[model samples]
Target: MHQLSRRGLFTVAGVAALGSTGALLGASPANAAVPDSPRFDLSGAGDNPVAKKSLHANWVMQSFAYDNVHQHLYFAQVNTENSDRANAGDLWITKTDTEGNELGSMALHNFGHGVSIAVEPYDGSVYLWTEWMSSSSGFGTRIGRFAFADGTVLEKTSSAVQDRTPSIGDTMINPQPAIDPSTGRLLVRYKTGEDQPRIVAFDLADARAGRLATQHRLAERALPSRGAWGAANPFQGFTAYGRYAYLLEGRAGGPSYISVVDLNGTGQSTVVDRWETTAGQSLPGREPQGMAVWMHPTGPRLAFGFHSNTGGVRQASVFVKTQFV
Candidate 1:
């Protein structure tokens, strides 16, 4: 892995790949001319075969998180065969310096489908959420708490059925979890309907005591389509900044977007802004999935993880917006 400055991450080739529409350079219409609104920049991009046999599997990046305390970029990935229950797979956590240099990596067995990662600001502890199934009739979910020092699992919990919503036939697919830096509240979101998702906020105290606090409905516009391959769930990724929560919509080989919701005094969510990628400038064959936001030395940036397949290789591209609301 190579370390590059935020600006250097966007090479001429990357810019060309994104097209000349300059869609990523524009600001959201709802926001005023805030000095640092939100702008997209390529942080780093590459592809590698996920490790096999536990050494270095060719893993496909699924989710991302930024550790402000330690200033590290954390990514969660799952190997190809491990995505589904057909073959056993492993989940990997790759930690890199702010500049994208690999510092350390860890692999957890019998776990694949790494969906999301979040870092606790107070203690720099890492939290990862993953999904697994043993057979066509069986499914389960797990949340692993790891030490930032060595990626060792300090605590782990699992459920044969987690966050089930029978009304919509959804069972915590791609659950996005984040810890509010200001309040230390653990927020986890999962899709319950075509466009409606539920967000649950757990007090740190209650979480440590194995109890979930309460959940609320996230109000957002209807998705353009059901989803890639006709899947009903449309939400792909999520992160929290201040009192607002941002969600990414998954549209394979189509336009990309991020929905901004205001978590104000009422504790009710209102769709305040919907940012879409430029029509002709979107990633040709990629679907945006995961998102993470943190204040950088230069400014606040929004990072996204896009998944794609090229030449039989599963790839993940990390893109960032240095100036984001």
Candidate 2:
């Protein structure tokens, strides 16, 4: 998927594009026809609106992913000289009740942009990936596994690739990560700013072993552009079920769809379904960061979150769907 440009200069803040079955198909009635909106009533997901924005602060709550391992949520909070002084404002994981109260908290370093989260079902640990700047001033991606008592972390450097720029801070950055339950290996997909953005895969099973097991290239395709300046264009989201992986792909001019692949072995991903975004478009703001995150054992439905920039206003949305296929 192509990175859609913003109206003004790009800031350090991360933005995500959203692609849903309904939005991509332009099927307003079908999306509208859902018999029931998400039952956030039980999970206490919808009852609370962040009373004080400062509680979440510079932290975009949606950017963080859920830790189904411990039934908690994890996010980062930046501590500048101006804010709370005692703490440097560290990365935190807190237990989320239906009421949105802070159940427990833990601290981590300042890991900035391109943050993606996943939960390891086998051990009930939360995994987060983001770019970290070392004291010497070099930036690299690190994967941290946060647990109740202790944690395991790994600093990642891309294996030498001929086409892509060596894993830099903000170039064609890494795409989101998805885990295959059957294989017990972490698959990280990334892109390089080549003629067609080059997508690479890394295996997280062996941090001690720094080589990627499988690497494939996403066929280069130009994206579709949204109409108007602030339209609801689509972005990508991913989820894995059994051996099948689902990917939401968006184009600049107009095409968008969900691609399904057998990620179990060395087979090429094929397009199982296709879709388009809502019309009367405008430039889409940040995509849905963790809208597609899911834990297979906790629930059957695939859970997705949406932080909508409706008419330039940020509105939060979450979706849970049972796979029809």
Candidate 3:
């Protein structure tokens, strides 16, 4: 089975074929729950199908994460286009057995826009980041707290206090969220500035207390490319390993490199080492969209997933055991 791309997982056209937009958001009436079974073994290698055989739906899956506590994997979808009175598809959370069999599932409210997911142990609870449509400025983005188990957002409202927009041509991409275990605060660094665009971090607690503190920002020289299309990693896609953060930035035309930041202090980011995704070629096709990065459970190895343009079809890509050195 072919892997799905980050953006392709929720195409406007794809949602229409899936039935009602509500279905796409995970709004299904209760029914007999499917028993849990180990469906896919991550330790091994192969495709991990998000949906079941009976539901063979071509959902363009964007967000992906596994809850260590509940042992559940979560991902979300949105409308291919605005229809069915739903602007975006709903967020879906599924619990699977060790064999990856569908055990039970639940759907959250419609975001009206796409949503991103990231999980981290914080203050005896899990931290998450989601983007929901905001009417504050008539258009804005919300990044707040959510309950890990049932996907209930603890942040009550979509406040526009810290909202920032990208440039005209560039769009805000997936934000790789991480939490500082030491501080018990959620931390995130995203890029959206027009010139010398940067990745900045803040303590969720501070933002909640109305402080909105910024830890640090990535320097211009550290970026992949300085030109319009020569930007690094198309999105603010990144991964974290032991006090360090690994990020991928792609310039417009081609050339993508990784930036490593030390979180030992106020999360100061520095480009320790740099390498292109492909040695000599330019990054191919529509800016290689969404990305996921994380550290291997055992070693300094890093894990990542990216969008690949395979013959004009966007597919999800997997790169494992990427050494930190």
Report how far off residue 56 is in candidate 3 (Å): 9.0
For candidate 1, write residues 14-82 as lDDT tens digits: 101112221111123211211222333322232221211111234556676777667777776665442
Candidate 3 steric clashes: 29
* 1-325: candidate 3 lDDT, tens digit per residue: 1112232323333201112211111112111121221111113222223212111122333444444444444443333333433323344444343223555443333432322445554578654455544332211144544554542322223342133222212234332344333233344444444432233333445544434422221111112223553443344355444345555566434555655554432222353645445422322342322233332234223433333343534333334443323
TM-score of each: 0.61, 0.48, 0.51
Worst 10 contiguous positions by lDDT, candidate 2? 1-10
- Give the top-scoring candidate (lDDT): 1
- Flag regions of model 3 displaced more than 4 Å: 1-57, 66-73, 76-116, 121-127, 134-140, 148-176, 180-185, 202-226, 230-233, 249-257, 261-274, 278-297, 307-317
**Models, CA RMSD each:** 12.5, 13.1, 14.7
TM-score, predicted candidate 3 vs. hidden true structure: 0.51
What is the number of backbone collisions in each predicted candidate, taken in the order shown?
Answer: 10, 19, 29
Between candidates 1 and 3, the one scoring higher on lDDT is 1
Clashing residue pairs in candidate 1, if any? 38-323, 38-324, 49-58, 50-57, 50-58, 50-59, 51-56, 51-57, 51-58, 52-57
Ranking by TM-score: 1, 3, 2
